[model samples]
Target: PAFTLESLDGVPVSLEGLRGRPVVLNFWASWCGPCREEAPMFRELSARQGSGDGLAVVGILFQETNEQSARDFIREYALAYPNLKDPRIDTGVEYGVSGIPETVFIDAEGVVQHMDRGGLTRERLNVGLEKIGVPAL
Candidate 1:
């Protein structure tokens, strides 16, 4: 599903705007333990967003009532990707999210390539990226 959610600072992050690149769309909540565990790995991958990989990492805050907590989490993790606001979890609903930490990988053509639920590991994340045609780095 296509969507445009605003960052904590109100900057719009649109799925369609990230065309021509593979996308990593993560749905997570600040209070989630699994989300916390994967934040740093995501932070690392976020740095590769605009490189030759032409990949984009984006986060959709799911079921998080406190915007400040989300902001603090981003700050603490030093995440480089765009973390968008989804106060009502609307985007999650569209994606059939039954739990936090669900990640969807989209190809350069904007086609959904893979989906992973629960925690993400380096191996699993690499596998997902592989499906989207991202090379090992």
Candidate 2:
């Protein structure tokens, strides 16, 4: 029921594995225009902070057609971050997601620090990362 989604490369990724690291769990749908617009920014932030210091960004695709569709979206956006297909919307419901483009910031201790609904900008993400002690790029 917790965050457990396979990465594009077929790696098993779970929220538990991201413990002791600051995580940004973003819920998105390929059909959502706002999600499409903000996805690139999220990808950039994830790539910039992916390595050392345990800054993790995991994407959950909501209402996706299938794994291939999700994979295609990742490729289309050139998203380098790990993504999981949340077809049943289980993760979304657990996080109280009301709609697409909901971003939740989880701290190193796995506590939910901030929740943002709708599109996000690089500036907002930087502030959220700072709040979680992950440092901005």
Candidate 3:
């Protein structure tokens, strides 16, 4: 299932727009402790994979009420990737997200490779990248 959502900057980001590249769709919330713990790893991976022909890191904010709080969280973490706000949480439901800090890896062909539940370390993320037909970071 394809979905479109607005980034924190109000720009539209669609899963369809990212079909040609491997994608890391991470579901998280501002208040989640695990989400905070894994944010640095996500930031590092996003930086490494953000350039040419690299993976796309897309963060989906879940169960968040304050948009400003989400914005602040992004700034505090110095996240350089796209973060989509899922206020109504329709996207989360579509993705079968049951908890915070869940991660879904999608390949270039838009096929899901893995669904990780809980905070992710760099090592785990690398494994998922490999599963999605991308080189380990």
Ranking, TM-score, top scorer first = 1, 3, 2
Error of 1 at 102 (Å): 0.7
In model 1, pairs of residues that clash are: none
* The candidate that achieves the highest lDDT relative to the unseen native structure: 1
By lDDT rank, best first, the candidates go 1, 3, 2
Clashing residue pairs in candidate 3, if any?
none
lDDT of 1 by residue, 29-97 (tens): 889999999999899898887688899999999999888899899999998788999877888999888
List model 2 lDDT by residue over 1-109, tens digit each.
3578766577789989888888888888777788888888877777767467678888888777666766777889988888887767888998999888989989999
Q: Give the whole-model CA lDDT for all candidates, comma-separated.
A: 0.91, 0.81, 0.90
- Tens-digit per-residue lDDT, 78-103, candidate 3: 99999998879999999999988899
What TM-score, computed on C-alpha atoms, does each candidate reach?
Answer: 0.96, 0.87, 0.94
State residue 28's C-alpha deviation in candidate 1, in Å.
1.0
How large is the C-alpha RMSD of every model relative to the true structure?
1.0, 2.0, 1.2
Error of 2 at 133 (Å): 1.1
Query: Whose TM-score is higher: candidate 1's or candidate 3's?
Result: 1
Error of 1 at 6 (Å): 0.7
